[model samples]
Every structure is written in C-alpha cells, then in structure tokens.
Target: MTDHHDRPHHDLIEHPRPRFAPWLVEPMLRNKGTYLKVALAAAMINIFGLITSLFTMTVYDRVVPNNAFSSLIALSIGLAIVVVFDFVLRVLRAYFTDLAGADIDHDIGGRVFRRLVAIRLDQKKGSTGALTGMMRELETLRDFFASATMTALVDVPFIVITLIFIAILGGAVVWVPLAAIPIVVGAGWLTRPALDRLSARAMSEGLTKQSVLVETVGALEMVKTSGASRLLGQRWTRANQQHSDSSTRQRLVSTIATTVAASANTLAYAGTVVVGVFLIADHQLTTGALVACSILSGRAVQPLATIAALLSRLSATRTAYKQIDAMMETGSEEPRGTALKPARFDGRIELRGVAFRYPGAAEKTFDGLDLVIPAGQRVALLGKVGSGKSTIARLILGLYQPQEGLVMIDGTDIRQYDPHAMRSLIGTALQESVLLSGSVRENITLGRPGVDDAEMLRVAELTGTHGFMGRIANGYDLVLADRGEGLSGGQRQSISLSRALAGRPQLLVFDEPTSAMDQTTEMQLIDRLQTELQGRTFVLITHRPALVRLVDRIIVVEAGKIVQDGPRDAVLQSLQRPRTAA
Candidate 1:
C-alpha cells in the first residue's frame, strides 16, 4: 500500500488535446430545426411589432386629422389582425424554445452521468463535492437554454432591424438611440471582472462546504464516537459563511450592472423623445413619427437590459461548462484491450522481478519479488499488517498495474487480456464488505446474467447468509440500504461473501473475509468455503493462524520480501519456533 501523502498528485494516464463536449453540441444540432422555427417566429413577431408605430402614425396623421370615421374603422380592423398575428407568433416562439431546451437537457444530462460513472475510480478521488457541484451546474446550463437569456440573445439581433425601421421613421434623430447602445453594453461589460471574481469565490466555497458535509455524513458514526461533531459543524459553517458572502457580492455586482443598463435604456428613450420633438417642429418629422421613434428606441434597448439581468447565471454556467469539459477530456481508465472473448483463466498466477511503487511514493513497496501459485492450488498468504498481502491480491485482480516487471496469468501477460473479462472470471471478498442498495438477490447476483434462484440460494447458504435472509420479511427479496446500513457487520460480510461466490468464478481470493464473524461463525464459514472452493484456485490472505488449515501451502511475507514458503506443515512448524534476539 502507498502512503496517501506520497501518492502522485496527477492523473496516471495522460490525455491528448481537449475533447469536444458532444452533450453541448449534439443537443443544439438535434434541435436546430426547432430553433430555426423559433427564430422565424421571433422575426415575424418583431415585424408585427412595427404595426404599433404604423398604426399610431396613420391614426394621428391621416384618420384623426381628417376626421374620416370609415378610414378609422377599417384601419382599426387591420391593426387588430396584426396584433393577433403577433400574439400567436410570440406564443409559438416560446413553446418551441422551451421544447428545444428540454431536448438539450435530456441529451446532456444522460451523457454527463455516464461519463462520470465510466471514469476510473482513482481519478474520482476527492472530487465528490466538485462532481455534485458540476451536476448542479449542468442544470444551470439546461435552464439557461430555456431561460429569458436565450430570448434576449435572439432578440438582440432584431435591434438592428428595429434601428433600420426607426431610421425610416425619424431620420437623423435615430443616432440618439443608436449612441446609447454602447453605453448599455459597456455597463454590462464593466461588471464582468467583478462578476468573475465573486462567482469563482462563491463556487469554490460552495464546493468546500458540500465536501465537508458529505464527508461528515459518510462518517457520522466516527464523528460522534470521536466527539468531533462540533468541530465538523464549525468547519461546515465557516465554509457556508464564505459562500454566502461571495454570493451576496456577486448579486450586488449583477444588480448594479442591471440598474445601469436600465438607466441607459430610460435615458435613451427620453433622448429619442426630445430629439424627435425638435425634428417634428423643424417639419422634418410628423407628430406620429416622433411618438413612434420613442417606442422603437425602447424596443431596441430592452434586450440589453434583459441580458444584463442574466449576467450572473451566464457567469456561473460558463464556469461550470469549462469544468465539465475538463472532466470529460481527462483520460479514462485503461482500455479493456482487444481480447474480448478470452479463454477461461486456469488461475496459474506468476510475478517475476515485480517491483511496485504507488504513484508519488518515496520508496517501492517491494522490489524484485517473485512468486508463483500453480493452477488448482489452495495457498494462504500469512503476513503482518503493511506487509503487502492485500497488495498482492489487488495485483492478481489487475486493480493496480505494477511499476516494474510483468504480472502473468497462465503463460500470457495479464495486460494483454481484457480487464472486464478477466475480472468476471475472478471472485474477490475483501476485509471491508461493500454492499449497494438493492434486494438480497440483486446484490448477490450483481448483474451477472444467467444466475438464477438455485445458484443464488446455494451460495447464500454456503456463506450462511440464508440463515438471516429467512428471518427477514421478504427473504431473498429484502432490500438493503446503501453500504448495507441495516445489517450487522457479520451479516454484511456474509452477503459480500455470497456475492463473490454467486457467479461460480474460476478464481477465489479472500482477504480477511471472516474478520467480522464470531469464532463459531468463522469456523462454519471456513468449513463450507473450503469444500465449495475445492477444485478452484484459492488464495487466502489472513493474519489468523486458524485459517492456515484450509490451504495446502503457506507463504510468509515480511518487509516487502517472501521470508518463508513451504508445505502447510513446514510453515506451521517454522511459525511455532521461538524468534531469536536481534
């Protein structure tokens, strides 16, 4: 085992150039036709918007001035039709925009989850809180697509159309509203530095707080037993306070930008009105046209204010997008190799000149170590703690690659075999039992197809799990909480053992598998396991001498080297002898 502090601080696998996020791109492309519909609807809506000014111009300058009642009636009907068309277009755009957003949300959400699961377990270390935060950030992106921000972005281009129309209505005076565009835009831009600073701080503090909470909850028993609940609470509260403070600052900056944009819009509208009045007095514009210019100026500035209002969400979403992209681009676990359908392993394991040091370790765990366990042999690895007993088991399982030399299965390099296929043929039960949230049958079978009730019950009975399952109301259907929370330590271990044996694997590796059991229960389990594992290749890693009787051979490891290896009787005799003084 490697010391935690000395372990390498970077990914063991390197990646090429950053990979593109299909989640972000695919959704947009899939809904491109819908987006096009929305855009066309928006364009129609804006075109109809011009009807207001035109209606005003005609009513004031033509109908009202001439007192033509029939003209007024006819014009009012035309205006009503335009208003109805505009309303319908607005609703269609909103509906289609939301539909497109839903499609994007569904697409990206599934892909991100799958990616998170597929990444190597080593790569996920210390990232639980960040991953949780990233998941929420994904929601932010989904909501952004459906949000008014999208509408504002789409409407922004229509400002050009609005300006073009306004120019025709009120010629040179159009400059008043056009000049105000930069002022509103600059106001939004100026706050970005502040927004970025505060948002980053807030996100960092938020992840810290979440990490602490998850760690504390996961180890609640330890915290309570150790009397460190208050300390944990203080740590969480401090992180929360920092997050809240940063969030407050972020909101303040966003608000100021929004207010500045609104003020600019108001000023622009006022300027257009005053300037248009002068143009009308100079006989360069009609009375109705002056009024129309004010309306057009307001329409043009609205999108900028909306965008300013959405700045905070945009900033947060941008940060999240970058984080997700980086996570996806990071190298995944080693490939499963080309040996898709490997031959059944005979379980003849060998290691030659195998030197292994964990990443960033100051010294190797072992150097030039050689060992062989022939097919159909039952071997016990006896060693003191930290003597690499468990490391040997992991190496055999291909959980971690050796830094030097080769780990061979049968006569071939284990790396040449497909990892998934290799693992399927080996059964392992570790010192710490792990059980997921599922029914007893599901946990035992563990997604192994073709495992039926009789096989499940046989393994369960052999591991003594059937005894407890009979007591539960649902029997094999009884559901367990995550980590087997409702079961006693011994019961959990039994289920873990049952899971290992359920698939009838060719290789069985047990590391302190009976640690949680009482003496009587341990003896019973060993007897049953010994008979069950008779013809299979079995490796037992244990400190208890009682377990040595199950194996035909014994090996003792000390200080990163094999100190003793012999038939069971010879090793037992050597162990019984007194140690000499140093």
Candidate 2:
C-alpha cells in the first residue's frame, strides 16, 4: 500500500540492484526438502546398482573354479535378495523424483498464472500467443524433471564409484576407462555450442508457429469474412517449415553427440578386455576380474552418454527457465496497495491536470486534461474513434495509471484504494462482449456468491437476455460455445449486459455497449438500461447521437481536450448548429 512516488528524492535517485537471481531461486528453495529426499534415494539406488558386477565376480572366482555347489546356491540366494532390494529402491527413487517434479509444477504454474493475471492491460497487449506458448514451456520443464535424463544426472556422481571398483579388481587396466572419461565428457562439451544454437532457434520457431495458429483460431470469423484464410494458411506453413528445419538440425547434432559418447565407451571396454587378457596370461589377474572390469567400464561411461542424448531437451528447458524468470522479474505488475474498503459509495469521479500516453506511442493521448462528474449523475463522453475516450474509462477503472496527475473517486485518489474493492463498485460492458464456455446461468452469475436464481433471472429479464434463454432447450442451463460463438451478436451483448447489471454496482460505465445490436434492439436495450440504472451514476462512451439523449449531460472531447461540457440539451443544440463560414 506504500506509494512508491512518496519516497524521498535521494531514495528515488538510487538504483536498486536487480532481484531476478533470487526470484529464480525462490521456487527451488521451496521444494528443497523434496529434492533432498530424491537425492538420498538416488544415492542408495546407485550403491545397490554395483551388485550386478559383484555377483558375477563372486560366481566365477569362488563357485565355478571350486565346484562348490553349496556355495553357488548360497551366493545365488544372496544375490537374488540384493536384486529384489535394489528393485524396490529404484521404484522408491522414481516415486520421489515424480513427487518433486509435481510439486515444482504446481508451485511454478500457480505463481506464473497469478502474475499473468495481475499484469497491467497495457503491458499485456499483442503478446497473447507468446504468453500462451510460455505457459506451455512450463510443462516442458516439468517433464524434464521427471524424465530419465534427471535420473542420469543424479547417477553421474556414481561414475566415480564404478571406476574405483574397477581399479580394485584389476590394477592399471582401470586406466583405460580413466582415459575414456575425458573423451566421453569432451564429446558432449564440444557439441554443446551447436546444440545450444539449434535448440534456441527451434524454440523461437516453435513459438512463432504457435502464435500464428493461435491468432488464426482467435480471429477465424475475420479470416472467413475477409477471405484471408489462404494468406494465413501460407504464413503458418512457412513458420511450420522453419520450425521443422530447426528441430531436424537440433536432433542431428544431439544424435551425433550421443553416438560419440557411446562409441567412446565401446572403445574403452575393448581396451580393458585386451589389457585384462594380457594380465591373465601373465598371472596378474583372474578371468572373473576381467569380466567385472568390462562391466564397470560401461557403468563409468554410461552417465556421460545419457547426458549427451538428453542435451537437446536440457537446452530447451534452460531457455524456458530463463524466459519465465525474466518475465516474472520485469513484466509482472507491482503489488497492490492496502486501502479501506466500503460497501458502497456515491460515484464522484475527478481527473485533475492529467497527462497520459500509450506505451509505445510518440504523441501524447492526453495532456493537462481535467474533468469532474458529480455523484449520481449520468454523463456521456462523445469523441471520434481515436480521441482517447476509451482511455479515460480505463483510467477510471484503475486498469492504467496516469503518467502525471491524479484521478480521484469520491474525493480520494483512486491509487489509494484497494483496486479490487474499487472495481467491485463499478460495472462495465465493452463493444466486444467476452463470454466463456459455460451454461447460461453460470455466465450470468459469473461465480458471484450471493446471486440466487431469482436475482439472476431478474437481471436476465432486465437485459432482455431471457428472451433468447427460453428459446434454447435448457433455458438458464443452456450451454454456450467458447466466447459465445453460438449466439448472435445482439444475444451476446445482451448476456454481457445482464452480467454487468447483475452486480448492481454504484457506477456503471458502458463503452459502445450496444454497438453490435440492430437499431430496434439498441433502442430497446437503452430504454431497459435507463430504468435499471436509475439512481446509479452512469458514464457512456459512444458515437451514436441517439444514445447521448439517455444521459443527463454531454461532454465533447476533441484532440484529447474537452471542447464543450454542459447540460444535455445545450450541448446537443451547439453540436447541431450549422456553421455558415469557417
């Protein structure tokens, strides 16, 4: 609730260090306990994994050469017990890994969603497709944590254990695996630059393709009406091709790295066998020891090979993590302020010496503009298409803050009030009606707690939405398509109006609310709205002259400056007056 602007001049001059590093680490810290448990389980699993080579050595050296059947039986039973216990540990390790991955998914997903919702409207413009793709990247990270790649990473340290065991069984032959370790790791390292570049390009191309498809789907009506389907399809095809090419390149590089690592391990095993044969001939080592040394060499190099195979996925996951981290750090909206909450209040709006501009515009949208509306009065804002009328409404709604000046509601600065509480007192319906896929009753109630059936039906009747509800088979229970696709424009607008009115807000703002309606429907809706909005303050932003008559006063804005403000009749007469000479 602290006003950032109220900080001292010296404080404002000081630049704070970036907080992104800590923000990135916060989620990992939250799941530290689960990660620790997974690590412990992995260590145990790796320790038990050595049993295979140990059992082979014992059978060949102790049982086979001695013709000891009883010893063989005992060894088989003991090894069987070890194998069963190892299997259980592996299962537990996988379970814990999955548990940790799920926790991270839930935690990170919720955090990102909350931040996305709270971001300023201006900041979110035109990035819908990219944002959607970023959300999907979270799934990529979740899968990475749960995949065999993660298991290999955990087992990487156990490579040392395998090498040490080999050295103990056969001296100096272990040097072959020791020599191959650098080759295995170096192959992966050498391919990293290519993998990073290709993976990054592929991710960019994939997001572009996704964005095109999302845009096409969202504006299908426009594409159909304007005959742009072919153009859009061709554009998507190009994007898809680029994405596919990048993916192919990335896969090729990853495959080469994996092959190199695997080949190195194979060569190391061959070297160990040749050396062990010489040692056996010289009476320096046993045949069982040679077998154990080969097995241990493979184990020593397997982790590096696994890592090489997973390089592409790891690179993609790294890119996603960095992108999400930057978004949360810089793109998220500031926290809301703490302010008093009131049940209801008179709707008095004031804008004092306001100066504003859109995010990327060169010119100001408004400069030194001032306006005042008394409580419980209806007013209309008349302006041309791009004259900043809608911008004013957004400011009043607290969706955007003025670059300079103050916007007050009921004598208190809007910034000083709890934004949610302030918005709850106002109702709005825009030109484009937004409706989610749900039943008719659900759309009307909008999850408001105390809105009973009667209240919902009452608002429906008030907005004339009930007229179409009865035509549908399920009445209030009738399901709607995504974004109200099945309904006519007027029907959609009516439902949106019903939703706005259901709240009975003290202040009602409509921005060309009836733009989609036919003339007759528009007039009927205006008449009904007039009665429903009685005793409440209303602000209508519209170009229609007919709609202006419903308001008590009219304010004309030209070039972001108010040209005229007076009673409804006076303003109308002035606008109607014919000019003889310029």
Candidate 3:
C-alpha cells in the first residue's frame, strides 16, 4: 500500500441548514392560545386592581360625608363582588401560565434528551459533568416560565393603565409614581453588568462543582485504591468556595437593586401623599382622592419593583437558554434526510488507502492503509498495544469516519449505509464491557423487540453464561446494577458476549473477548465460538496466542503499517523467529 503521510482530503459535506427559531419562543408560539388566555386574565385582573381605590373614593367622598347608609352598604356589596372576581381571575391566570409551562417543559425536555442521544460523538463538547449541568439548566428555564417572573412581565405593561387611572383621579400628582418608575428600573439596570458577571461566574463554578462531585462518585473505588481522596477533596473545596463566593456577590448585587426598587416604591407612595397635602391645603383635592392616589401609586410601582427583584433570575435563565441552545444545535450522528436505504451487508471488508486520526490526537492511527477480508473469512489482527488493532474494528463498524478514502463492506461504502440497520446485523464485543442496569435476560436481549427466551438462551449457552445463570436462583432474571457494579469482571464479560451473540449476527468482531476469563473458561469459550462462527465472517483482535485458533489468517500491524500477513500458522512461525542484531 502507498502511504500518504499528509492529511486526507475530502470535500466537506454541506448539510442544508434548517431554519432556526429560539427554542423557548418556538414552544410558547405553539401554545399561544394558552398564553393569550393568561394575558386576558391579567388584563382583567389589572382592571379589577383599580376596584379598591375606587371603592375607597366612593365611601369617603360620597357615602360617609353625605351620611348615605344604604349607599355605603351597596358600595360594600359591590366591592365584595369585585374582590371575588379579581381572585378568580388571578387563579385562572396562574393556572393557564402553569399549563403553558407544562407544555413547553414536555416539548423542550424531550427534545434535549433526544438531541443528546442523536448528536454526533465528534460534535459533543464539554465533559460529561458539564453536559449534565447544561441539561439541568432546562429546569431553570422551566421555572422562569412557571414562576412569578411571567406574572411580573405580564403585569408590567398594565402600569400604563394604572398611570392613566392615576392621571384621571389624582391629576398633577400622577407624576410622582411615573417619575419613580425609571428610578426603580435604573436601580436594577445600573447593577446589571456586575450581576451578569457574577451570574456567569456562579454558573461556571456550579458546573465545576458538579463535575468534581460526579467524577469523585463515579470513580470512588479508584480514588480509594489510588489514594486520590486528598487531591479530589481539595478540588471540591476550591470549587465550593468559588461557587459560594460568586453566589454571595450575586445576591448582594441583587439585594442592592431590590432595596433600591423597594425604596423607590415607598418614596413614590410618600411623595404622592406629600404632593397631595399641598393640593388638599388649597382645597384642590379631597382627602378621599389623596388616599386613592397613594394606593394607586404603590400599585403602579409594584410590578416595577417585582421585575427589579426578578432580574437575577431572568439573567440566570438567559444564561441557561444560551447553553441549552448550543447543545440543541449540534450536528446529529444520523443526519436528517441523508440516511441511505438499508442494505444487506455480506461482511466483505475493505479499507482503501484509508487515513484516520482521533478527534484531538496528534498522530494518525492509520495513513493510506489498505486491507481486505473476503466474505465468510475468519481473520485475527495481532499487534501490540496502540498498534491500530482496535481502531480497525472501530472503522469497520463505522463508529469513526476516515479523513480520506473509504471503508467498504460488500463492495459498498459503509458510510452510505444506514448506521442503525448496518449495526443490527453485526456482533461486537469490545475489550472493556459496559452493561446497563437491567436483568440478565433484558441485558442479553438489549430491548430487541422480537428476541424470545429461546434465542436468549442459545446465545447465553454459546458464551458460557448459561452455567452462571443456572447457579443464580433467579437464572436469567438476575438484576444487574448500573455498569454491572455488583458483578465480577468475567461475569460482566460473559453478559456482554451473550448480548453480542443474541441476534445470530452475520459478522462477529471480538476484541480481547476472553481477557477477563480464566484459562479453562477461555478455552471453553474459544471452542464454543469456533463452532458457533461457522460460515460467519469473524475478526478477532488479541495478543493472546490461544485465540489464534479462532481464525485461519493473521495480520500483524506495527506503527500504522501491516508488517506481517499470511496463513495463521505461518504468521505465528514468523513471529516466533528471533530478531537478529544489525
């Protein structure tokens, strides 16, 4: 094969970009009718909010001074009715708001999870902990929608209505609350830059803290064995300190803004009263109208004060939206509308001048490499660690794409095949086995819908898992913990092997499959595999001499090049020959 040390060149695949809309906006738009209901309720609520002042004015100016007892009773009853109506409307607004929030949560939460599952492995950024933190931000977004933030936002526009009422009732004194509006808003605005910085720092430190915690818990055994507790503890302490400090500073800034807004509210009420005193002295305004002015002024600034206090949460929610949006926009592994029709693969593998390197690696694992394994052929890749043995298996499975050339199966490029359908017909066992939480039968079947117990038992027997299943009281019903935590290494490997074999696959790729087994177990597994793999294409990657029996041909790779290839026994003889000094 001609080696090309230069990087492989291929035209970039241009995917048609889908028109993007803000995720939060899109969901709300879909639920517009529900939001419209909330808005109408809020409008009615604000109109009803005027009832108290109006009732106070009527009682003080008309009923009390005129000694109209029947009039007072009638006004009281009317006021009581208005109060009930206001209460009902508020409740309805909250209900509709929460209903809309629920709909959004369902849609966005499902989309986030689906994106996480479908996103291309190479497109994924950040550590698992960071990703987890980003996923948690969805809760922040949902809470912002469901909390008082929405109410405050909706109520803000009604400040104009309140102002109009104040102008009509209190005349020139309307400017008192109107003047305070900007002061309250500015208080929140002035501290925003610092608040934003603190918010971002707090979020960053929070993710760091989450990362440390998750890392420590996931590797608790390793930390204990390796005496890494002190190091991890120090990291945890530092992250906690940073997070706490950022949070404290953030709250302090937020408190300052809230205090200013509250003071503005109080001053607006006091200012209104002070101005009304002059008008009262001149007999230009009545006591009842002055009292009504004070009440309306407070109402006017209440939403402003609320919005000021909620600035911190809004900032946090904004930060969260950006993070989630970035994650959602990542390229999916299976691109939409681009997947080829499913094709039956005959397991004839070929790598034509293939060149590949890992995402961030400095050196290429394979450069201009050529290899072929005909249909129904059994082959073993024998190489030292880091000699491109496992990389070959990954390429054949299309887990990673080559930077140049093609990896073909049955004279067709593997890239052109639908990944799901292609993988379903192949049995793969890696060097490290990972088992999910489930019973042995479920793990073996792996949620493949049509796999019955007969098929399950057949694979279990082939992988020698049937022996252990019989020993356990529950047989195939034995429940395994996450990552099979409670199981022995050999047992975990057995379960993994059984899963790979469950579908009676046409192609088998076993990488160090017997590494965890004892010599007797390995021998039995090899015997069973040899018989089971009849007429099937098999590729075995291993350093163990015993596994050579499973393949009729062997290829040895070194430093990204094939150094030896021949009949299995001949390759073994060549390897056994002693190296001579120059």
Candidate 4:
C-alpha cells in the first residue's frame, strides 16, 4: 500500500443552515377562524369594560347631580350584563388557546426532531448543547405565544373601539393613551440592551449547568472510581451561583423598567383627568363625556402597560434565540459520503492520503495515510498510542472522512454511497462496547431484527453470550441499563460481538475487542472469529502481537503512515530480525 506522509488539508463545500422555523408558524395559523372568533369574543368583553366606565362617570356626573332615580336602576342592569359577558369571553379564550397550544406543540416538536436528525454534520458541531435547550425553549414559547398572541390580537380592535368612543364624546382627547405609548416604549428601550446582556449570561450558565449535571450523572461510575465526584459537584455549584447572579441582575433591570412604567402611567392618567376636568369646568365638555374620556385613556394604556412588564422576559427569550442560532449555524467535519444502501459489498477496503482533525481541534489527529485490504482478507493493525490505527479503522467504517484523499470499498468512493447503506455493510465492536438500554435480545438484534428465539440462541452461543444470557431471569428479555452498567466488561464485549454477528455483516471491524477479556475468553473469541468469520473480511486493531499470527497479514502504522505491510509469515520473520522490528 502507498503511504502519504505530509501536509494538512481540510476543505469541502457545505450548505448553509436554514433561516426560518416554518414548522412552528404553519400550525399557529391552522385554525385561523377559531382564533379570530376568540379575538372577537375578547373584544366584546373589553368593549363592555369601556362602556361600563362611560356609564359610571355619566351616571355620577350627570344623573346623580340631576337627581335622576330611574338612571341608577338602569346602571345596575348594565353592570350585571358586563360582568356576565366578560366572564364568558375569558373562559372561551382559555379553552381555545389551550387547544391551539397543544396542537402546535406536537407538530413543532416533531419537526424540530426531524430537523435535528437531518442537521448536517457541520450544523451539529458548535456549542451544540443548545439543541437540547431548544426542546424546552420551544415548549415555553408555545405557552407564552398562546396567551400573549391572543391578548395582543384581541387588544387591537378593542383599543380602536375605545378610541372612537372617546373621539365622539371628547374630540382629540383620546391622544392621552397614544402619548403614553411612547413613554412606555422609551422606558423599555432604555433597558432592552442591558436585559439582553443579562439574559445571554443567564441562559449560557443555565445550559452549561444542565450539561454538567447530565454528564456527571451519566459518568457516575467513572467519577466515583477516579475520585472526581467532588470536582463535578464544585463545578455544578459554581454554575448555579453564576446563573443566580445573572438572573438577579436581570430582575434588577426589570424592576427599574417596571417602576419607570408605573410612574409614566400614573402621570399620564393624572394629566388626562386634569385636562378633562378643565374642559368640564369651562362648560366645553359635559361630566358624562369626561367619564367616557377617562375610560378610553385606560384602554389605550393597558397594552402598553402589559408590554412594559413583559419587556425583560421578551428580551431574555430573544437572547436565547441567539444561542439557538449558533447551534443551527455550527459546522462539523465534512463527510464525503451520503447515506447509502449497497446491495452487495465485497468488503475490499482502501485508504488514500487519509487525514483527520476533530471539530475545533488545533492540531490534526493523523495525516498522509494509505492502506488497502481485498475482500475476505483478515488484516491485523498494530501501532503505538496516537499512531492513527483506530482512526484508520473509523475511516474504513466511514464514520470519519479523510480530508486529504479518500476511503473506498471496491474502488468505489465511500462518499457516493448512502451513509446508512454503506455503514450496514460493516459490523463493528469497539474497545468500549456501547450496549444500549434494552434487553439482551434487543441489543443482539439491533442491526438486524426478525430473529426468533432459536436464531437468537444460535447467535448467543456463537459469540459466547449464550451462557450469561440464559442465566438472566427472562433470558433475552432482561432489560439492560444505559451502557449495560451492571454487566462486566467481558460480558458486555461478548454481547457486542453477538450484535456484530447478528447482522452477519460481510466486513467486521474489531477495535481491540479483547481489551477487557481474560486470556481464556480472548483465545476462545479468536477461535470463534477464525471459524465463524471465514470468507468474511476483518480489520482488527490490537496491541497484543500474540494475536497477530491469527490474521493472514499484518500492517504497522506510525504517525498516520503505514510503516510495514506483508503476509503473516513475512511480517513475523521481519519481527524476529536481530537488529530491526516490523
């Protein structure tokens, strides 16, 4: 095999992330008529509130002063009707808003997952924890939008009605509410940038803490064994404190904004009444009209007032969107291949100038590598640590793309094949057996299903997992914890071996599978591999030279380049040389 030994190259074209979240917007508009009806109902209720104020001021200012007894009795019935109408509208809005929220949540959540799954590798590589946060943020968004949107929608027509009523009763007098709007907006504007800063800090720290907590729990065993539990706890505590500090600062900004808003509303309300009273005293306006003008002022200020209170919250969520946008825009190591499904893979693997550098890595993992193995060939790869042996294995498995050149099967570029289809051709059992959270049978039959008890038993015995599997209470039905926490390393590896063979793949890639096995178990596995894997190609990366004799050939890699390659006998003879080693 030819070897490449120099230079670094990492360039491949990529598509940009999407800018819109259509999945969410589409569903919100699905029941437009219902939402409109709800808005109309709410408008009616708000109109009643405006009318009530008009009637109250008109009654006291005109009827009471005039000693009109019958006007008071008519006022009671008007007030009663307003109460009943408002109550009914409130209930209807609640029911419809809840129904809408639930439907949007389901549709958007599913689309979010689909988007997440289809996210290009480059898009998944940055401060990627935000994807998890997006799940929660989107749900919270649905809740907020459901309430805020309906109210905001309802306020538009309701607000216009009050303005018109005031104009007819007191010309140009309704401007009081409009005047207060700028003040409310100005107050929020002053605090928006500051709140954004605090919000960014708060969200970052909160997500970091969540990630740390999840990692600590997931690696509880390793943490305990390494005496690093205290380290994780300290980090978690510090994260919590930082989050608290950010939130407190945010609250302080909000408090100031809210105080300023209240002051503005108070001054505006006082000014409106003062203006109305002056007009009344001059006999230019009636007391009844003054009352109606006051009602209109209240209606205009309501939306602005509510907006002032929600200012901090809205800024924080927008800041959160910044983080989310980063995740959606992140780039990852570009793979040459698409998801593939090949009908027949002869299992001839090849590498050409293969090189790799992990995401955000300052230095490359390996470079200038080349190797090849024909179909049905068993090749043992041996090397020192950091020698690019495992990297080569992964390259062959199509998990990592080579930046410099290419990895191929049967001289066909791996990138041209569908990712899943290509991967289906190879079965892998790494040093760390990633046993999923499921029953033994489920784990064994992961890559390929449709296995009956008899077939499962056959695979179990073949991979030396039958004895332990049978010992479990429910045999293949015994549920395993995440990563098979309760199982010994040997047991886990055996089950993983079964999983590899379950699909009966043509190409088996074993990355030091015997790392945790005892000598007897290792020897047995080697024998089984030799017998059962006959006619199947295998790439075994291992440190033990003892097993090098089991394969038909040996390849020694160093510094991402192949140093030695030959037939088993030839490599062994070279190793025995007095002054040199293969």
Return the TM-score for candidate 3, rounded to 2 decimals: 0.91
Model 2 agreement with the true structure over 1-582: per-residue lDDT tens digits: 223222211111112235435544666677677677777777777776677787788888988999989988887898888878878877887887788778778888888887777677555523456667777888988888767755787789999888889999999899999998898788788888888777667777776777778879988999999999999899799989999999999898888888889899899899999999999999999988999899889888888889888887887777777666655654433435557676786999999999998776778899999999999899999978898889889899888888999998999888777766777778888778999998888888878876788889888888889887878777989888889897898899898888888868889889988888789878887787777777888989998777876799999988899999999999888887765333
**TM-score, every prediction:** 0.89, 0.92, 0.91, 0.81
Residue 105 lDDT in model 4?
71
Write one digit per residue (lDDT tens) for candidate 4, span 72-188. 778878788888878988888888877777777787667656556545542243233334555556655666656666666567556577777777777756677667778877888
**Model 4 alpha-carbon miss at residue 386, Å:** 1.0
lDDT of 1 by residue, 1-582 (tens): 344333321221122236446768888888989888888887777777788888888888888789989999998899899988888888888898899998889888888777776565434533465567667777878888876666677788999999999999999878988898898889889998789767667776776777777778777889999999999989888888988999999999999989988898898889998998888889999988888888889888888888888887888776667666766765454455455447587889899889987655677888999999999899999888999898889888777778788888887777777777787788889889989888988889987885788899999899999988978778988888878887999999999999888778878899998888898988888788778888888999998777887899999998789999999999888787765322
Error of 2 at 15 (Å): 20
Between prediction 2 and prediction 3, the one with superior TM-score is: 2
Cα displacement (Å) at residue 549, model 1: 3.4
Clashing pairs in 3: none
Candidate 3 ranges with C-alpha deviation above 4 Å: 1-22, 341-344, 579-582
Highest TM-score: give the candidate number. Answer: 2
Over 1-582, each residue of candidate 3 has an lDDT whose tens digit, in order, gives: 112222111101112234434666789899889888888888888887798898898888998889999999998899889999999998998898899888999998988898887676555666666778878888998998877767787899989989999999889999999999999989999988888778777887887787788878878889999999999999899989989999999999999999999999999999999999999999988889999989999999999999988998887776677667767777766635677755355778999999998777778999999999999899999888999999999899888788998998888887777778788889999999989888988889988975789999888888889988878888888888778898889989999999998877888899988898998999999898888888889999987789899899999999889999999999888777765321
How much is the lDDT of residue 347 in candidate 4?
88
Better of 3 and 4 by lDDT: 3
Off-target runs (Cα >4 Å) in candidate 4 are: 1-92, 95-104, 111-136, 153-161, 171-175, 262-292, 332-340, 359-366, 446-455, 545-550, 576-582
lDDT at 446 for candidate 3? 83
Give model 1's TM-score versus the native structure: 0.89
